[model samples]
Target: MNQTTNTVHQDVEYWLKNIVVGLGLCPFASLPLKENTIRITAFLGTDTEELLGFLEQELTTIEKSDTSQIETTLVAVPNCLHDFYEYNLYFDSIDRLIKINQWEGVFQVASFHPDYQFSGTEPSDRENLTNRSPYPMFHLLREDSLEAALKHFPNPEDIPERNIQCMEKLPEKQVNELFYYLFNKR
Candidate 1:
């Protein structure tokens, strides 16, 4: 891989390890990540159509592969959909693709962007960091795996609330430093 791709991978790993798992944003993330069942593919395309194409390819790849080998896929798009609003708007197309392909109940799409913001939260709110990643990504997850995880995890309904509480309790300096490191702005 090229230097840029290598750097993006490293940054993403840091975010997954330090921010997501470390902060307990997604309690279910750590095991799959540690087991190497989560595939992180970097797509360097800037066009929306091209990115969608890549997403479809990833979905198909995971769909066809054995779930034991590949539990999930994270398509990292550093070049496209940098703007959170645009990224949010693009979900319609992703949903349509899933519908057209009739992959509902089989797989689900989750989103993560650098500037992700919750509906009622302010731009600077710490809760937004829960959904933020080093780069914009479309997470393709298996419904069966999700169900299995949820079944094993106690009170899965409280995860979001717990994550918000964790974010709210974090120091401002630490949050800012995490994002700065994620984007490599230092």
Candidate 2:
């Protein structure tokens, strides 16, 4: 891999390990992560069409790969989607593509960006940090896997609330260190 690709992949992995798994944001993530079943792919393009194409390819790859070998895929786009608004708007197209391809029930995309903010929350809200990442990326997951995990998890519906609480309880120094990307843009 080139230097840029290596850096992007490393950053995504660090965020996954430190922020996502370490903080217990997603309970199911630990197994796939520890088992080395997570795949991280970088897209150095700035165009949405090209990104969509990349997404399509990754989606197909995950669909065909064995779940035991490739449980999930993270498509990191560091060259574009710098603006949260633009990134947020692109989800419509993603949903349409999923519907058009008839993969709605089989696959799903979870978004994480450096500047992710949930509805009804201010940009500085700690709860927004729940979905924030080192860069703009699409987390492609299998519906079957998610359903199975949720079935085994106690009170699966409270995961988001628990994550928000986790973020809210983070020490300032740790937040500044782990989420430097958000402060860098300010």
Candidate 3:
């Protein structure tokens, strides 16, 4: 990988470890992460077409692989979709792409960004931190894996509430440290 790609990949890995798994935000994340089954790729393309194509390739890659070898993928796009609203608007195309490819039910996309925000909350709300990441990345998850994980997990519906509470309890210093990329963009 080039230096930029390497840096972004490392940053994403750090965020996944310290913020996501360490905070207990996603109970299912730790296993794949520890097993080295999570794929993190930095997509440096700035064009929408290129990104969509790249995503299609990634989707195909994960879809064709066994769950034990490739559990999930995080495609980090640091060169495009900087605005939260614009990034969100692009999801329509993403959904359409998934449907067209007939992978809608097979896999799902989860979004994480530096400026991630929930619909009913303010941008400054601590709850938004739960979905925040160092860069704008699309998490391609397997529906079957998610279903299995949820079945084994207690009160899967409560995960969101628990994550929000976890975010709310964090100190400002800790937030700034864990989410330093929020303040310093590439």
Candidate 4:
């Protein structure tokens, strides 16, 4: 079992490494392109102007004389929400602003950082667990109503019926798996 786990871990490590290097680029250079690359952009939702500026700047940053192009994008997420809500919001925000003309490859980028709350600089970049305070990232995935908005919606009598319903917590492994589900490519 441990060996199998090791093999899986190594595979994941390899995949992640590939993502870092491959997706390290963006595709909209309009110049020549390169090899074995998957360009990407990561942006915060609250900053639209800056994100566009950064995207324009990267066009020069990743350009080469070769004819191959890197998949470029203007990724952005909401500043306040940790992951999902911000992710969704930013997607919506840019969905309107994205210029479809003069584009190459995929025009991708969104607010959701997979499991943003748990994915960060720590312990080999592992996902956050359910034992943890519900990550703010979850705010974007879907609101649990009373379970989530209790502090803001303090009118005890005004709670919604959908929120009043209880949800079972996932087991530890399940929680971890959920993080993987959200982050991992399908």
CA RMSD of each candidate after superposition: 2.2, 2.1, 1.8, 16.3
Look at candidate 3 and tell me the lDDT of residue 160. 94
Model 1 lDDT tens row, 1-67: 2236777788788888888888878888899888888888888867899888888999999989996
Candidate 3 residues lying further than 4 Å off, grouped into runs, are 1-3
Worst 10 residues of 2 by lDDT: 1-10
Each model's lDDT comes to 0.84, 0.91, 0.91, 0.33
lDDT of 1: 0.84
Off by over 4 Å in 2: 1-3
Better of 1 and 2 by TM-score: 2
**Candidates 3 and 4, the one with greater TM-score:** 3
For candidate 3, lDDT tens digit of each residue in 1-186? 123888889899998999889999999999999999999998997898899999999999998899888999999998889899999999999999999999878989999988999999999999999988888889999999999999999899999999999998989999888888888654
TM-scores, one per candidate: 0.92, 0.95, 0.96, 0.32
Q: List candidate 4 segments past 4 Å from native.
A: 1-15, 18-34, 40-46, 56-81, 100-112, 116-186
TM-score of 1: 0.92
User: How many clashes does the backbone of model 1 have?
Assistant: 0
* TM-score, prediction 3: 0.96
Q: What tens-digit string does per-residue lDDT give for candidate 4 at 1-186? A: 122333433433332343222232111112212333334333333455775465545544444312234333222222434545454565554444334423233233323244443333343233222212211121111112223434554464532222212112335464344345344533
